[model samples]
Target: MNFLSPLTEGLRGLGRAVLFLFTILAGIPAALLRPRLILQQIYSVGVLSLIIIVISGSFIGMVLALQGYRTLVNFGAASSLGVLVALSIVRELGPVVTALLFAGRAGSALAAEIGLMKATDQLSGMEMMAVDPIKRVIAPRFIAGLVAMPLLVSIFSLMAIGVAGGHAIGVELLGVDDGSYWSQINQAMHGTDIRDMLIKGTVFGLAISWIAVYQGYHAAPTSEGVSRATTSTVVVSSLAVLALDFVLTAFMFH
Candidate 1:
Protein backbone atom coordinates (compact mmCIF):
# COMPACT_ATOMS: atom_id res chain seq x y z
CA MET A 1 0.00 0.00 0.00
CA ASN A 2 2.85 2.37 0.82
CA PHE A 3 4.64 1.71 -2.47
CA LEU A 4 1.39 2.13 -4.32
CA SER A 5 0.94 5.49 -2.60
CA PRO A 6 3.77 7.12 -4.55
CA LEU A 7 2.41 5.88 -7.86
CA THR A 8 -1.08 6.92 -6.87
CA GLU A 9 0.11 10.36 -5.89
CA GLY A 10 1.98 10.68 -9.15
CA LEU A 11 -1.13 9.83 -11.16
CA ARG A 12 -3.21 12.22 -9.10
CA GLY A 13 -0.73 15.01 -9.69
CA LEU A 14 -0.72 14.29 -13.40
CA GLY A 15 -4.51 14.50 -13.52
CA ARG A 16 -4.55 17.77 -11.63
CA ALA A 17 -1.88 19.23 -13.89
CA VAL A 18 -3.86 18.25 -16.98
CA LEU A 19 -6.97 19.84 -15.58
CA PHE A 20 -5.11 22.99 -14.74
CA LEU A 21 -3.77 23.16 -18.27
CA PHE A 22 -7.24 22.75 -19.72
CA THR A 23 -8.62 25.47 -17.46
CA ILE A 24 -5.99 27.90 -18.70
CA LEU A 25 -6.75 26.88 -22.30
CA ALA A 26 -10.45 27.37 -21.69
CA GLY A 27 -9.83 30.85 -20.35
CA ILE A 28 -7.85 31.88 -23.41
CA PRO A 29 -10.81 33.32 -25.33
CA ALA A 30 -11.72 35.63 -22.50
CA ALA A 31 -8.10 36.41 -21.90
CA LEU A 32 -7.79 37.40 -25.54
CA LEU A 33 -10.53 39.98 -25.16
CA ARG A 34 -8.05 41.91 -23.07
CA PRO A 35 -5.15 42.17 -25.45
CA ARG A 36 -3.23 44.53 -23.23
CA LEU A 37 -2.63 41.78 -20.65
CA ILE A 38 -1.20 39.46 -23.26
CA LEU A 39 0.95 42.23 -24.69
CA GLN A 40 2.30 43.10 -21.26
CA GLN A 41 3.20 39.51 -20.57
CA ILE A 42 4.87 39.23 -23.97
CA TYR A 43 7.08 42.18 -23.18
CA SER A 44 7.82 40.77 -19.75
CA VAL A 45 8.68 37.24 -20.83
CA GLY A 46 9.67 37.64 -24.47
CA VAL A 47 11.27 41.03 -24.85
CA LEU A 48 13.22 40.72 -21.63
CA SER A 49 14.56 37.36 -22.78
CA LEU A 50 16.02 38.66 -26.03
CA ILE A 51 19.41 39.60 -24.64
CA ILE A 52 20.15 36.13 -23.40
CA ILE A 53 18.72 34.51 -26.51
CA VAL A 54 20.77 36.57 -28.90
CA ILE A 55 23.99 36.22 -26.96
CA SER A 56 23.54 32.49 -26.43
CA GLY A 57 22.54 31.87 -30.02
CA SER A 58 25.61 33.67 -31.25
CA PHE A 59 27.92 31.65 -29.06
CA ILE A 60 26.22 28.36 -29.88
CA GLY A 61 26.45 29.06 -33.58
CA MET A 62 30.09 30.02 -33.38
CA VAL A 63 30.91 26.85 -31.49
CA LEU A 64 28.97 24.72 -33.96
CA ALA A 65 30.81 26.32 -36.85
CA LEU A 66 34.19 25.80 -35.25
CA GLN A 67 33.62 22.16 -34.38
CA GLY A 68 31.88 21.42 -37.65
CA TYR A 69 34.58 23.03 -39.70
CA ARG A 70 37.18 20.84 -38.03
CA THR A 71 35.28 17.64 -38.78
CA LEU A 72 34.37 18.64 -42.34
CA VAL A 73 37.94 19.69 -43.06
CA ASN A 74 39.14 16.29 -41.93
CA PHE A 75 36.80 14.72 -44.47
CA GLY A 76 37.87 17.18 -47.18
CA ALA A 77 34.29 18.46 -47.11
CA ALA A 78 34.80 21.85 -45.49
CA SER A 79 32.33 23.36 -47.89
CA SER A 80 29.57 21.47 -46.08
CA LEU A 81 30.27 23.32 -42.85
CA GLY A 82 27.53 25.82 -43.48
CA VAL A 83 24.97 23.11 -44.13
CA LEU A 84 25.98 21.28 -40.98
CA VAL A 85 25.75 24.36 -38.76
CA ALA A 86 22.53 25.51 -40.39
CA LEU A 87 20.84 22.16 -40.06
CA SER A 88 22.09 21.65 -36.54
CA ILE A 89 20.98 25.08 -35.35
CA VAL A 90 17.69 25.17 -37.22
CA ARG A 91 16.65 21.57 -36.82
CA GLU A 92 17.66 21.02 -33.21
CA LEU A 93 19.76 23.48 -31.26
CA GLY A 94 17.69 26.60 -31.80
CA PRO A 95 14.42 25.31 -30.43
CA VAL A 96 15.77 22.98 -27.76
CA VAL A 97 18.45 25.30 -26.42
CA THR A 98 16.18 28.28 -26.48
CA ALA A 99 13.49 26.35 -24.64
CA LEU A 100 15.94 25.33 -21.97
CA LEU A 101 17.07 28.90 -21.57
CA PHE A 102 13.49 30.09 -21.48
CA ALA A 103 12.62 27.50 -18.90
CA GLY A 104 15.47 28.71 -16.73
CA ARG A 105 14.97 32.42 -17.17
CA ALA A 106 11.34 33.16 -17.96
CA GLY A 107 9.68 29.95 -16.81
CA SER A 108 11.26 30.03 -13.39
CA ALA A 109 10.40 33.67 -13.08
CA LEU A 110 6.77 32.88 -13.92
CA ALA A 111 6.70 30.20 -11.28
CA ALA A 112 8.28 32.37 -8.65
CA GLU A 113 6.12 35.37 -9.35
CA ILE A 114 2.93 33.35 -9.29
CA GLY A 115 4.05 31.34 -6.33
CA LEU A 116 4.89 34.45 -4.40
CA MET A 117 1.53 35.88 -5.25
CA LYS A 118 -0.06 32.75 -3.86
CA ALA A 119 2.15 32.89 -0.78
CA THR A 120 1.25 36.50 -0.15
CA ASP A 121 -2.44 35.78 -0.69
CA GLN A 122 -2.71 38.02 -3.72
CA LEU A 123 -4.49 35.32 -5.74
CA SER A 124 -6.88 34.95 -2.86
CA GLY A 125 -7.37 38.67 -2.86
CA MET A 126 -8.29 38.47 -6.53
CA GLU A 127 -10.75 35.68 -5.83
CA MET A 128 -12.34 37.74 -3.07
CA MET A 129 -12.72 40.64 -5.47
CA ALA A 130 -14.62 38.35 -7.90
CA VAL A 131 -11.82 38.13 -10.42
CA ASP A 132 -10.86 34.82 -11.95
CA PRO A 133 -7.12 34.57 -11.74
CA ILE A 134 -6.87 31.94 -14.44
CA LYS A 135 -8.24 34.26 -17.11
CA ARG A 136 -6.74 37.39 -15.68
CA VAL A 137 -3.30 36.01 -14.87
CA ILE A 138 -2.38 32.64 -16.29
CA ALA A 139 -3.88 32.71 -19.76
CA PRO A 140 -2.13 35.85 -20.83
CA ARG A 141 1.27 34.44 -19.92
CA PHE A 142 0.47 31.18 -21.66
CA ILE A 143 -0.55 32.91 -24.86
CA ALA A 144 2.47 35.14 -24.74
CA GLY A 145 4.75 32.11 -24.55
CA LEU A 146 2.97 30.51 -27.49
CA VAL A 147 3.35 33.70 -29.50
CA ALA A 148 6.98 34.37 -28.64
CA MET A 149 8.70 31.03 -29.10
CA PRO A 150 8.36 30.59 -32.86
CA LEU A 151 9.52 34.12 -33.49
CA LEU A 152 12.53 33.67 -31.23
CA VAL A 153 13.48 30.45 -33.03
CA SER A 154 13.35 32.25 -36.34
CA ILE A 155 15.62 34.99 -35.10
CA PHE A 156 18.00 32.47 -33.63
CA SER A 157 18.32 30.11 -36.60
CA LEU A 158 16.92 31.51 -39.81
CA MET A 159 18.07 35.01 -40.65
CA ALA A 160 19.72 36.66 -37.70
CA ILE A 161 22.16 36.17 -34.89
CA GLY A 162 22.82 32.43 -34.73
CA VAL A 163 23.37 31.71 -38.43
CA ALA A 164 25.21 34.96 -38.85
CA GLY A 165 27.61 33.99 -36.07
CA GLY A 166 28.23 30.68 -37.75
CA HIS A 167 28.92 32.40 -41.04
CA ALA A 168 31.42 34.70 -39.43
CA ILE A 169 33.25 31.80 -37.86
CA GLY A 170 33.14 29.49 -40.85
CA VAL A 171 33.70 31.84 -43.76
CA GLU A 172 35.64 34.80 -42.43
CA LEU A 173 37.64 33.15 -39.70
CA LEU A 174 38.26 29.76 -41.25
CA GLY A 175 38.42 31.03 -44.80
CA VAL A 176 35.99 28.43 -46.07
CA ASP A 177 34.90 29.28 -49.64
CA ASP A 178 32.17 31.91 -49.18
CA GLY A 179 30.25 30.89 -52.29
CA SER A 180 30.06 27.25 -51.32
CA TYR A 181 29.09 28.13 -47.76
CA TRP A 182 26.05 30.16 -48.72
CA SER A 183 25.19 28.04 -51.77
CA GLN A 184 25.22 24.71 -49.94
CA ILE A 185 23.17 26.17 -47.10
CA ASN A 186 20.64 27.57 -49.55
CA GLN A 187 20.45 24.27 -51.41
CA ALA A 188 20.35 21.89 -48.44
CA MET A 189 17.85 23.75 -46.33
CA HIS A 190 14.25 22.88 -47.12
CA GLY A 191 10.77 23.83 -46.02
CA THR A 192 10.68 20.83 -43.74
CA ASP A 193 13.60 22.18 -41.75
CA ILE A 194 11.78 25.43 -41.11
CA ARG A 195 8.59 23.57 -40.31
CA ASP A 196 10.35 21.39 -37.78
CA MET A 197 11.80 24.43 -36.01
CA LEU A 198 8.47 26.22 -35.76
CA ILE A 199 6.64 23.13 -34.61
CA LYS A 200 9.21 22.40 -31.95
CA GLY A 201 9.18 25.99 -30.75
CA THR A 202 5.41 26.05 -30.38
CA VAL A 203 5.20 22.69 -28.65
CA PHE A 204 8.00 23.51 -26.29
CA GLY A 205 6.41 26.82 -25.47
CA LEU A 206 3.14 25.12 -24.54
CA ALA A 207 4.80 22.52 -22.40
CA ILE A 208 7.05 24.94 -20.54
CA SER A 209 4.30 27.47 -19.86
CA TRP A 210 1.96 24.71 -18.73
CA ILE A 211 4.44 23.28 -16.30
CA ALA A 212 5.49 26.64 -14.90
CA VAL A 213 1.98 27.85 -14.26
CA TYR A 214 0.73 24.54 -12.93
CA GLN A 215 3.56 24.22 -10.48
CA GLY A 216 3.07 27.73 -9.22
CA TYR A 217 -0.69 27.50 -8.96
CA HIS A 218 -0.51 24.32 -6.93
CA ALA A 219 2.41 25.27 -4.75
CA ALA A 220 1.72 25.46 -1.04
CA PRO A 221 1.27 29.05 0.04
CA THR A 222 4.49 29.49 1.94
CA SER A 223 7.88 30.97 1.25
CA GLU A 224 9.57 27.57 1.21
CA GLY A 225 6.87 26.19 -1.01
CA VAL A 226 7.29 29.06 -3.45
CA SER A 227 11.03 28.41 -3.60
CA ARG A 228 10.46 24.74 -4.26
CA ALA A 229 8.01 25.54 -7.03
CA THR A 230 10.50 27.84 -8.67
CA THR A 231 13.18 25.13 -8.62
CA SER A 232 10.74 22.52 -9.88
CA THR A 233 9.68 24.79 -12.71
CA VAL A 234 13.23 24.95 -14.04
CA VAL A 235 14.08 21.30 -13.46
CA VAL A 236 10.86 19.86 -14.80
CA SER A 237 10.66 22.26 -17.72
CA SER A 238 14.21 21.42 -18.82
CA LEU A 239 13.66 17.67 -18.67
CA ALA A 240 10.37 18.05 -20.50
CA VAL A 241 12.05 20.11 -23.21
CA LEU A 242 14.71 17.48 -23.83
CA ALA A 243 12.25 14.59 -23.82
CA LEU A 244 9.80 16.40 -26.09
CA ASP A 245 12.58 17.33 -28.47
CA PHE A 246 13.45 13.67 -28.91
CA VAL A 247 9.85 12.63 -29.44
CA LEU A 248 9.13 15.52 -31.80
CA THR A 249 12.27 14.83 -33.81
CA ALA A 250 11.42 11.15 -34.14
CA PHE A 251 7.90 11.89 -35.28
CA MET A 252 8.69 14.85 -37.50
CA PHE A 253 11.84 13.51 -39.12
CA HIS A 254 10.66 9.94 -39.42
Candidate 2:
Protein backbone atom coordinates (compact mmCIF):
# COMPACT_ATOMS: atom_id res chain seq x y z
CA MET A 1 0.00 0.00 0.00
CA ASN A 2 2.79 2.36 0.90
CA PHE A 3 4.63 1.59 -2.29
CA LEU A 4 1.50 2.22 -4.33
CA SER A 5 1.10 5.69 -2.88
CA PRO A 6 3.73 7.22 -5.12
CA LEU A 7 2.17 5.65 -8.18
CA THR A 8 -1.20 6.99 -7.18
CA GLU A 9 0.17 10.47 -6.77
CA GLY A 10 1.85 10.24 -10.14
CA LEU A 11 -1.41 9.33 -11.82
CA ARG A 12 -3.18 12.18 -10.07
CA GLY A 13 -0.53 14.59 -11.20
CA LEU A 14 -0.78 13.41 -14.79
CA GLY A 15 -4.54 13.85 -14.73
CA ARG A 16 -4.21 17.32 -13.35
CA ALA A 17 -1.65 18.28 -15.95
CA VAL A 18 -3.96 17.08 -18.71
CA LEU A 19 -6.91 18.97 -17.29
CA PHE A 20 -4.79 22.11 -16.98
CA LEU A 21 -3.79 21.77 -20.61
CA PHE A 22 -7.43 21.67 -21.68
CA THR A 23 -8.16 24.79 -19.71
CA ILE A 24 -5.19 26.58 -21.24
CA LEU A 25 -6.26 25.55 -24.73
CA ALA A 26 -9.83 26.60 -24.08
CA GLY A 27 -8.64 30.02 -23.04
CA ILE A 28 -6.52 30.57 -26.14
CA PRO A 29 -9.01 32.76 -27.96
CA ALA A 30 -9.21 35.24 -25.13
CA ALA A 31 -5.47 35.10 -24.57
CA LEU A 32 -4.81 36.12 -28.17
CA LEU A 33 -6.54 39.41 -27.53
CA ARG A 34 -3.95 40.21 -24.87
CA PRO A 35 -0.95 40.27 -27.15
CA ARG A 36 1.03 42.41 -24.74
CA LEU A 37 0.98 39.76 -22.04
CA ILE A 38 1.96 37.01 -24.44
CA LEU A 39 4.84 39.07 -25.77
CA GLN A 40 6.07 39.79 -22.27
CA GLN A 41 6.01 36.13 -21.38
CA ILE A 42 7.77 35.37 -24.65
CA TYR A 43 10.59 37.70 -23.68
CA SER A 44 10.76 36.15 -20.26
CA VAL A 45 10.75 32.60 -21.51
CA GLY A 46 12.39 32.86 -24.94
CA VAL A 47 14.64 35.89 -25.04
CA LEU A 48 16.07 35.18 -21.63
CA SER A 49 16.85 31.62 -22.68
CA LEU A 50 18.76 32.69 -25.81
CA ILE A 51 22.20 33.10 -24.25
CA ILE A 52 22.23 29.50 -23.05
CA ILE A 53 20.76 28.24 -26.31
CA VAL A 54 23.35 30.06 -28.38
CA ILE A 55 26.32 29.03 -26.26
CA SER A 56 25.15 25.45 -25.94
CA GLY A 57 24.29 25.18 -29.63
CA SER A 58 27.64 26.59 -30.73
CA PHE A 59 29.70 24.34 -28.48
CA ILE A 60 27.64 21.26 -29.25
CA GLY A 61 28.02 21.88 -32.96
CA MET A 62 31.77 22.17 -32.62
CA VAL A 63 31.90 19.01 -30.56
CA LEU A 64 29.73 17.15 -33.05
CA ALA A 65 32.10 18.18 -35.80
CA LEU A 66 35.07 16.92 -33.87
CA GLN A 67 33.43 13.57 -33.09
CA GLY A 68 31.84 13.21 -36.51
CA TYR A 69 35.15 13.83 -38.20
CA ARG A 70 36.52 10.76 -36.44
CA THR A 71 33.53 8.59 -37.36
CA LEU A 72 33.49 9.61 -41.01
CA VAL A 73 37.24 9.00 -41.19
CA ASN A 74 36.66 5.25 -40.89
CA PHE A 75 34.66 5.27 -44.12
CA GLY A 76 36.94 7.75 -45.93
CA ALA A 77 33.88 9.95 -46.35
CA ALA A 78 35.00 13.02 -44.50
CA SER A 79 33.38 15.33 -47.04
CA SER A 80 30.00 14.14 -45.78
CA LEU A 81 30.60 16.04 -42.56
CA GLY A 82 28.03 18.59 -43.57
CA VAL A 83 25.51 15.87 -44.28
CA LEU A 84 26.13 14.19 -40.95
CA VAL A 85 25.99 17.41 -38.98
CA ALA A 86 23.00 18.79 -40.78
CA LEU A 87 20.96 15.60 -40.64
CA SER A 88 21.71 14.89 -37.00
CA ILE A 89 21.07 18.44 -35.86
CA VAL A 90 18.07 19.18 -38.04
CA ARG A 91 16.34 15.85 -37.60
CA GLU A 92 16.96 15.21 -33.91
CA LEU A 93 19.63 16.98 -31.92
CA GLY A 94 18.51 20.55 -32.51
CA PRO A 95 14.94 20.35 -31.21
CA VAL A 96 15.58 17.77 -28.50
CA VAL A 97 18.59 19.49 -27.00
CA THR A 98 17.07 22.92 -27.24
CA ALA A 99 13.91 21.77 -25.51
CA LEU A 100 15.85 20.02 -22.77
CA LEU A 101 17.81 23.16 -22.10
CA PHE A 102 14.67 25.25 -22.24
CA ALA A 103 13.05 22.91 -19.77
CA GLY A 104 15.93 23.28 -17.37
CA ARG A 105 16.20 27.04 -17.58
CA ALA A 106 12.89 28.53 -18.60
CA GLY A 107 10.60 25.75 -17.41
CA SER A 108 12.02 25.72 -13.91
CA ALA A 109 11.80 29.48 -13.71
CA LEU A 110 8.18 29.42 -14.79
CA ALA A 111 7.30 26.85 -12.20
CA ALA A 112 9.03 28.75 -9.46
CA GLU A 113 7.50 32.06 -10.43
CA ILE A 114 4.01 30.66 -10.57
CA GLY A 115 4.47 28.69 -7.39
CA LEU A 116 5.70 31.79 -5.61
CA MET A 117 2.70 33.70 -6.79
CA LYS A 118 0.45 31.03 -5.36
CA ALA A 119 2.32 31.10 -2.08
CA THR A 120 1.93 34.85 -1.82
CA ASP A 121 -1.82 34.59 -2.41
CA GLN A 122 -1.59 36.50 -5.66
CA LEU A 123 -3.43 33.76 -7.51
CA SER A 124 -6.11 33.79 -4.85
CA GLY A 125 -6.19 37.53 -4.99
CA MET A 126 -6.99 37.36 -8.68
CA GLU A 127 -9.93 35.07 -7.94
CA MET A 128 -11.23 37.54 -5.41
CA MET A 129 -11.25 40.16 -8.14
CA ALA A 130 -13.28 37.91 -10.46
CA VAL A 131 -10.31 37.38 -12.72
CA ASP A 132 -9.42 34.11 -14.35
CA PRO A 133 -5.72 33.57 -13.86
CA ILE A 134 -5.84 30.72 -16.34
CA LYS A 135 -6.78 33.09 -19.11
CA ARG A 136 -4.73 36.08 -18.06
CA VAL A 137 -1.59 34.41 -16.81
CA ILE A 138 -1.14 30.74 -17.67
CA ALA A 139 -2.41 31.05 -21.24
CA PRO A 140 0.07 33.72 -22.17
CA ARG A 141 3.00 31.73 -20.85
CA PHE A 142 1.74 28.69 -22.70
CA ILE A 143 1.49 30.57 -25.97
CA ALA A 144 4.90 32.13 -25.50
CA GLY A 145 6.51 28.78 -24.81
CA LEU A 146 5.02 27.35 -27.99
CA VAL A 147 6.15 30.30 -30.08
CA ALA A 148 9.61 30.50 -28.57
CA MET A 149 10.37 26.81 -28.83
CA PRO A 150 10.31 26.66 -32.64
CA LEU A 151 12.34 29.84 -32.92
CA LEU A 152 14.88 28.51 -30.48
CA VAL A 153 15.08 25.26 -32.40
CA SER A 154 15.63 27.16 -35.64
CA ILE A 155 18.42 29.14 -34.08
CA PHE A 156 19.99 25.98 -32.73
CA SER A 157 19.97 24.38 -36.18
CA LEU A 158 21.56 27.43 -37.73
CA MET A 159 24.33 27.45 -35.14
CA ALA A 160 24.96 23.77 -35.61
CA ILE A 161 25.13 24.16 -39.39
CA GLY A 162 27.30 27.23 -39.45
CA VAL A 163 29.61 26.59 -36.50
CA ALA A 164 29.70 22.81 -36.40
CA GLY A 165 29.29 21.80 -40.01
CA GLY A 166 30.65 24.72 -41.96
CA HIS A 167 33.34 26.39 -39.87
CA ALA A 168 34.77 24.14 -37.19
CA ILE A 169 34.97 20.74 -38.76
CA GLY A 170 34.44 20.86 -42.50
CA VAL A 171 36.30 23.97 -43.52
CA GLU A 172 38.76 25.28 -40.95
CA LEU A 173 40.26 22.12 -39.50
CA LEU A 174 39.50 19.09 -41.67
CA GLY A 175 40.24 20.68 -45.04
CA VAL A 176 37.26 18.79 -46.52
CA ASP A 177 36.12 20.16 -49.85
CA ASP A 178 33.55 22.85 -49.11
CA GLY A 179 31.82 22.21 -52.42
CA SER A 180 31.30 18.53 -51.64
CA TYR A 181 30.02 19.26 -48.16
CA TRP A 182 27.47 21.91 -49.16
CA SER A 183 26.37 20.04 -52.28
CA GLN A 184 25.77 16.83 -50.37
CA ILE A 185 23.65 18.63 -47.80
CA ASN A 186 21.61 20.44 -50.46
CA GLN A 187 21.01 17.19 -52.25
CA ALA A 188 20.32 15.09 -49.16
CA MET A 189 18.01 17.37 -47.17
CA HIS A 190 14.43 18.01 -48.23
CA GLY A 191 11.44 20.03 -47.10
CA THR A 192 10.10 17.15 -45.04
CA ASP A 193 13.18 17.18 -42.86
CA ILE A 194 12.60 20.80 -41.93
CA ARG A 195 8.86 20.30 -41.46
CA ASP A 196 9.35 17.36 -39.12
CA MET A 197 11.73 19.33 -36.94
CA LEU A 198 9.25 22.18 -36.62
CA ILE A 199 6.63 19.69 -35.60
CA LYS A 200 8.93 18.27 -32.94
CA GLY A 201 9.81 21.67 -31.51
CA THR A 202 6.18 22.69 -31.28
CA VAL A 203 5.18 19.49 -29.52
CA PHE A 204 8.08 19.73 -27.11
CA GLY A 205 7.21 23.32 -26.30
CA LEU A 206 3.61 22.44 -25.58
CA ALA A 207 4.64 19.65 -23.24
CA ILE A 208 7.21 21.71 -21.33
CA SER A 209 5.01 24.73 -20.80
CA TRP A 210 2.05 22.67 -19.68
CA ILE A 211 4.09 20.71 -17.17
CA ALA A 212 5.69 23.80 -15.74
CA VAL A 213 2.42 25.63 -15.18
CA TYR A 214 0.54 22.59 -13.93
CA GLN A 215 3.06 21.82 -11.25
CA GLY A 216 3.19 25.39 -10.09
CA TYR A 217 -0.53 26.03 -10.19
CA HIS A 218 -1.35 22.97 -8.11
CA ALA A 219 1.61 23.09 -5.79
CA ALA A 220 1.09 23.51 -2.06
CA PRO A 221 1.85 26.94 -0.75
CA THR A 222 5.10 26.17 0.98
CA SER A 223 8.77 26.64 0.24
CA GLU A 224 9.35 22.93 0.00
CA GLY A 225 6.35 22.48 -2.23
CA VAL A 226 7.47 25.21 -4.58
CA SER A 227 10.97 23.74 -4.72
CA ARG A 228 9.60 20.32 -5.49
CA ALA A 229 7.36 21.72 -8.22
CA THR A 230 10.25 23.55 -9.82
CA THR A 231 12.38 20.42 -9.85
CA SER A 232 9.50 18.31 -11.12
CA THR A 233 8.91 20.75 -13.96
CA VAL A 234 12.44 20.23 -15.29
CA VAL A 235 12.50 16.45 -14.86
CA VAL A 236 9.05 15.87 -16.30
CA SER A 237 9.47 18.28 -19.17
CA SER A 238 12.80 16.76 -20.23
CA LEU A 239 11.47 13.21 -20.15
CA ALA A 240 8.33 14.26 -22.02
CA VAL A 241 10.42 15.90 -24.75
CA LEU A 242 12.56 12.78 -25.22
CA ALA A 243 9.58 10.45 -25.23
CA LEU A 244 7.79 12.68 -27.69
CA ASP A 245 10.89 12.79 -29.88
CA PHE A 246 11.00 9.00 -30.09
CA VAL A 247 7.33 8.75 -31.03
CA LEU A 248 7.47 11.68 -33.44
CA THR A 249 10.58 10.29 -35.13
CA ALA A 250 9.00 6.90 -35.65
CA PHE A 251 5.93 8.40 -37.30
CA MET A 252 7.82 11.04 -39.24
CA PHE A 253 10.45 8.65 -40.53
CA HIS A 254 8.21 5.65 -41.01
Best by TM-score: 1
Which numbered prediction scores highest in lDDT against the true structure? 2
Distance from true location, Cα of 102 in model 1, Å = 0.4
All candidates' TM-scores? Answer: 0.96, 0.95
**Which lDDT value does model 2 have at 20?**
80
Clashes of each: 0, 0
lDDT per model, in order? 0.89, 0.91
Model 2 misplaced regions, further than 4 Å: 1-5, 163-166
| lDDT per residue (tens digit) for residues 1-254 in model 1 | 79899999989999999999889989999999999999999998899988888888888888888989888898999999989998888899999988998999889999999999998999999999999999999999999988988877877775332345888898889998889988998899999999899999999999999999998988999889999999999999999999999999999877
Write the residue-wise lDDT of candidate 2 on 4-79 in tens digits.
Answer: 9999998987787788889999999999999999999999999999989988888888888888889898999898
- Clash list (residue pairs), candidate 2: none
The 10 consecutive residues of candidate 1 with the worst lDDT sum are 155-164
